[model samples]
Target: MNWKNIEGLDGVESPGLLVDSDKIQQNIDRMIEIVGGAEHVDRLFPHVKTHKMPEVTRMQVDAGITKFKAATLSEAQMAAGAGASEVLIAHQLVGPKLDRLATLIEDFPNTKFAVLTDDPQAADAINEKCGDADSPLDVYIDIDCGMHRTGIPLGARSDALRAHIDSLSGLNFAGLHVYDGHLHDPDLQQRTDKVKEILGKVALHEKEHPSPRIIVGGSPTFGIWAAETSWHLSPGTTLLWDFGYGDAHPDLPMTIAAALISRVISKPGEGKICIDLGHKSIAAEMPLEKRFQFPDLPDAQPIGQSEEHLVLQTANAASLHVGDIVIAIPRHICPTVALHSHATVVSGGRVTGDRWQVTARDR
Candidate 1:
């Protein structure tokens, strides 16, 4: 009945992922609008980890977003293969990943690839592995503004690392990479202020030094970085608006573009109905209460979940017969998308008979 619905569900299978093709394009357009307009599309270096499909990456490329960011080599390969002009493997490449990176560069010569480095020794190691003078690897100084997952703090140590990277002959020192994904305060103003405070030092450096680029923030801080033209915006979750983000940032114009389709399989108990959706169907990292939501049936509560079955308790279960369709919106669409091999594409309120491959996942 809402944006997540498809006109026809007869051919659609249960416990499947569905994406609204039109809404995806709309979200891309809105992202462009949020950060100035069509002209500023170049500043948007979206992360393809959410919808990992090459079709989605190509859609962004078609919308004038050539530069991209990814958390894995496979995602970078997917983006480059899908026509990305430049892609950054936002995560550090270690061990065999370096050999894979070199091979990726050789395979996708058309698309320039960059990587994150927070340690000088690791930078030297990367230079030794994949960097070449003829086709040097682009290196960005990963700054741990807050998300201490992988980055150096912005200070003398980071500055020294930048200098060391610059001295390296085989690598092309890029700029600073700050992923404040930890900052997801629902209050827009608080989130804005927090990110600004973290980037304050980097902002000052940019004012003094001219050329080094700064890629900052993700979906939560999209608008915060959008207003500042200098910094590049890398948002992953915004691509396929999820129940988690949609509920958190209601003011944002992004609409729900993907939904989990499930069917009631059995009325096992008086107050419960079992569906096909299970731990394998959706992301299970979140708490049980926040795993997924039944939009049509808000009162539905997950009473049991296993590999291929999810039992829910709701007063409406009595009215729901076997094979009755139920639509679920995942709290975290990125991992949930990875759980599926392909997503059914929906358009014009119906199935488009198209399935986009989840090419960037499982590797």
Candidate 2:
């Protein structure tokens, strides 16, 4: 889309962020279509941690999605209050976080809130909380299946954990959470094999436990899990059209829907130009120090970036004099998006003048 020449955008802005709302909706639709056809699954409870925008979350809810997996307590409460019927705190809710969880549960009594934990102490804590409130708190046991980030190793100990949760009164073992973020490699065949192997183990454990009502599959493994089980696949980033997550599959439909639109601030050296956006604007987690791309100026490439300046490699650097607008696609979309407060909505070459707030800016 030629964003610069947009109708409502002509006199309003320069050096701003832009989001293709159509593209985002399309991405969400495509993901739903992919997971919707699962053999006998109830529904895909998409993870809302990716795009923390309440508007985007409502878009999912309006599409008949009632369940969601949140990475944080705030995400769960925010999403549930907005419209989510069931919100899963996909991470272990421990320490002082439990107090907030208790309060949110009190606030949203109709909403289903669940948390994941491998430790029995958390189960005891949940029991205490429930005892205090005189109600039950839904819970899930995190099973470590290859990915060593969280969860207890799936085996004898896992079986014991399930039994322990079953014996508890205030805590209910909702299901299992297996996330294989490592499987998001470029090699499609290898990734598929890994997913199959990991899921196979989870299926076995589920059979033995036969207690959890919801089996939460991690993000990258959503497609496989949707195919294998009748549970929800927590696919979050699938909504935001991130370049970094889908880097493995070059043919994936989700493209970089958001870009950091900046302007040439200076012509510092030979064959180089500095842009207004820098690490402050783009994601610092990007693999490279810089990334430059422009359909209009395809030859230009990113070389490096400073705190406030981005240096691009281009032969026709002189063509992009001071104040020339340049749009940069960040390697990662999540953090990059949080860097901006509003996005300049555009269509084709005309600006739509729609501004979207970065709702997930808080740490």
Candidate 3:
């Protein structure tokens, strides 16, 4: 659909992703404020998987956020190229990916890059690749803080793995990376207590083999870790909040920085209006209500969604006409951002300059 008539969005079209640069800056500032002030800004190692755009990474770098956590090798490379002084590939890389990581280290000597490893085999692979290139890489021991996702259990076995990594030739044992993504209770105190309980294990592990550093927590428990402990924080979704986290943690001081701008395409039934937004436009990992929220039509309920259309049932359907734009905030901003190739930049209530490329979408 055409968006030329939409004020201030001269070259934009329907089914576009709009990102408010001001809101992003506000989110960054709020994170710094949450961690006390600019002095603690370096403690933030925000995960770049949420917003893969290099422009956003550069924004964080400009804000004095030096370290970043990336899920993919491409994302780590993107962060290093964006002038991020330090980047952590939070996921394990094996086979050729390990070689690529070594290449990245060789390519960007100025940027410090590291990867997570829970298995000794993966650590050996990393060590082999880095040794072949004659470039040493920093390594973080990924601890499974009750997540059971991908990390060594927190105990003697974990300490043994850390010892193994320390003995490796081309790898340096930098610190411990504990991600408490499962503790997403809406109550602030509950989240705080859960984080404390999980980190208590890390503290015990440190008693025998003290870690040089520790990076912990994700967006769900960022405020808890930021206030309760002095570990490096790795919150990703805080930069661009979604309905899931925002509704779960109302105490956080973040605004919705990204939105899906769709247009009404058809009037299918008496109370049904179909929009251009489909499963592809927004993230569908959560339930219907939690997947997205429509600010323009608060009472609108998603009745059905197909590849290219999202049918909604609402009493205000009659009020919305064809070609009318509707703004929606996704339940998960990370995958929602990956669906689009570019994001239209909006500032001061108007589209400003060109769109930002979603740089690291594939890998």
Candidate 4:
């Protein structure tokens, strides 16, 4: 049975998310194997923002992975509910989120919650919302590597800020969070070399001040981080990888475990076919043609898309007919998965009719 083939998929509704339960487990196992198996499971702080499913988080917990990283408070809450011992919200809190984090910490007393902060003001703000010193919120100093999207640079200022944050009664300075999602070279050694360069600075910083923990990299740079002894890994896409990461790093060894199923709604012309997949179904942040690639119709050209329809020109359109369910591998799966409320789960080569609720999708 093909990993991509879903038995009894004919009954599934059109334009729905499809996730392989078997493949999900395989990915989890592979992740543990890559990180040096069960003994080192403590180092695996996978991000739940990819699947956003409590079931997936629970599976990781069952596999002995207790730590999780989240992008949203809802995701953090879901992970906590799934029995995660530690949940780190990698994004900085602002406005009402600080209060919401307080609620999350309060609700899941057993789960140690942490937040990443690059700003001293934000750290001070988070400290104010942590309730009290007895339950101090764990705060990791987000260090800006080359990707300046977030985090403070590892410098004198960062050291001073860490000292300041440590002084706060309600905040525990966790460690460093260096997220370098911007680094993506198809070549593994090149990526590794770049990571080693970055680690030089991290080494210097750690030499200066130790004891706190550190988290590094998303799925793209996961392999590089895994080789290191000190850094804790928080790779999200390893669970349900998409074509974007799949194509770029074949060496990573993660399967494309998620997809979107759409129906061919119209045969617009001789070589043009329109599918029910639209920007609303699949992620449209990428270019029109790069959004999704048909596995069978690999040469299909995506010409246009709207909220409910996507027009594609393909020589294979002659073989396709109306009502035909088209399986698409999203170039960007994270946003595409978020578009659907739930996914039709495929287990052991058959559609289980069991749904995997994307529990923390938008939240």
Top lDDT prediction, candidate number: 1
| lDDT per residue (tens digit) for residues 24-76 in model 2 | 77776776766764232247778877667777778777766778888877678
Model 2: lowest-lDDT 10 consecutive positions: 33-42
| lDDT per residue as tens, model 4, 1-363 | 353466798889988998988888999999999898898888899999988999999989999999999999999999999999999998988999888888888788899999988888988888887737876778898889999798878888899988998899988888988888888999988998888888888988788787389888888888888986646998899899988888999988888888888889999899999999989988899789888888878889988899999999999999999998888989988888888999888887889889988889866
Residue pairs in clash, model 4: none
| Worst-scoring 10-residue span by lDDT in model 1 | 1-10
TM-score of 2: 0.89
TM-score (C-alpha) between model 3 and the true structure: 0.95
lDDT comparing candidate 2 with the true structure: 0.71
Query: How many clashes in each structure?
Result: 1, 2, 0, 0
Q: What is the TM-score of each candidate against the true structure?
A: 0.97, 0.89, 0.95, 0.97
lDDT tens per residue, model 3, 305-334: 888899999999888899877778788899
Instruction: Tell me the spans in candidate 1 whose CA falls farther than 4 Å from its real position.
Output: 1-5, 208-211
Candidate 1 lDDT tens digits, 129-182: 998987678999898887768898877888889889888889988888888979
Tell me the deviation in Å of residue 87 in model 1.
0.3
Q: What lDDT would each prediction earn against the true structure?
A: 0.89, 0.71, 0.86, 0.87
RMSD of 2: 2.7
